[model samples]
Target: MTILITGANRGIGQALAELYQDRGETVIGTHRAPDAGHLRELDVTDPSSHAALAERLGDTSLELLVCNAGVNLDQGQALDDGYPPAMWEDCFAANVTGVFLTIQSFLPHLRRSDAPKIAIIGSQLGSQTIASGGGYIYCASKAAVLNLGRNLAVDLAPEGFAVGVYHPGWVRTDMGGDRADISMQESAQGLAARFTALNPETTGCFETWDGQAHAY
Candidate 1:
């Protein structure tokens, strides 16, 4: 299967790419600025970059598209001086707009697959039911992308596409911090299973890394 993962330079995205490659799947891991590695350069916020990537792939059928690229700019911002206008714009650009543009640009490649799937890496904090009142920009962006995934699922179902939004848990990554609940390996394995289990029936689901249904 041809799987393309955005923001695969580090953290969960990198782990997912490595896992898929280990399974002998064709993995196209993309980063905003790649070094001397196998990862491709792709700035998800730029539509022109997406076009360039598509042109490079040349009709490659993508079985899975993982919109894992995101940012958490309002991590410890104070309510007084935190979450400024520019920060909001930057966070949304990477977290929401990037995901949407990627899906839009890759629709053709995804359509070529018999069972195309889209996995959006959302967060539990995005859920209205689980809101804890911090990281407003990041949470709102995630909520927007979650809604985007659900609507996309509805729109793409007839075309044999399954879209799922997921919360990868409090993993021990740069974003998740060292005090997080789980390791990258554990989260990656569970998420791989979730991606594998995604189908027509499970489309539009908001799920956790460990296979539990998440409240919207």
Candidate 2:
């Protein structure tokens, strides 16, 4: 199977890429930085960058595409003036628009495969039932992307494609921080299983890393 993961230079994306590669699959790890060593260049926030990456891949068949690139600009912001206009723009651009653009640009490649799957790395914070408090921008962006994944699943189901939105556990990554709930290995393993289990019957599911269905 051929898998494409965005923001694979570090964090959960890197762990997922490494896991797939070790399983002898063709893993295409993409990073925004030019000096990302073995990873390919892909700025998820830029449509031109997605186009360039797609062109570079030519007719390569992609079995799985993981939209893991995102940003949390409003992390500890106050309810006052802490969340600026630019913060919202940048957060949504990377977390929501970037995911949509990546999927749109890679549809052809995905169509080349017999069984294509899309995994969106969303957050539990995005769940309306679990809306805690802080990180408003991140929550909103994730919620938007979750909706995107659900709609894409509906639209792509007839084409033999499945889309699953996942809340990778609070992992020990740069994004999740050191005091998180689970380790990167655990999250990656659980997510891999979730992705593998995704099928047309369960296309628009919002699930957790441990394979449990999350509240939409």
Candidate 1 stretches greater than 4 Å from native: none
* Weakest ten-residue segment in model 2 by summed lDDT: 31-40
Estimate, for each residue in 70-133, the C-alpha lDDT of model 1 and write its tens digit.
9898988999877899999999999999999999989999999999999999999889897688
Q: Could you tell me the lDDT of residue 161 within candidate 2? A: 95
TM-scores vs. true structure, each candidate:
0.98, 0.98
Residue 55 lDDT (model 2): 96
Model 2, position 114: C-alpha lDDT score: 94
Model 2: which residue pairs collide?
Answer: none
- Every candidate's lDDT: 0.93, 0.92
Per-candidate RMSD, Å: 0.9, 0.9
* Candidate 2: C-alpha RMSD after superposition: 0.9
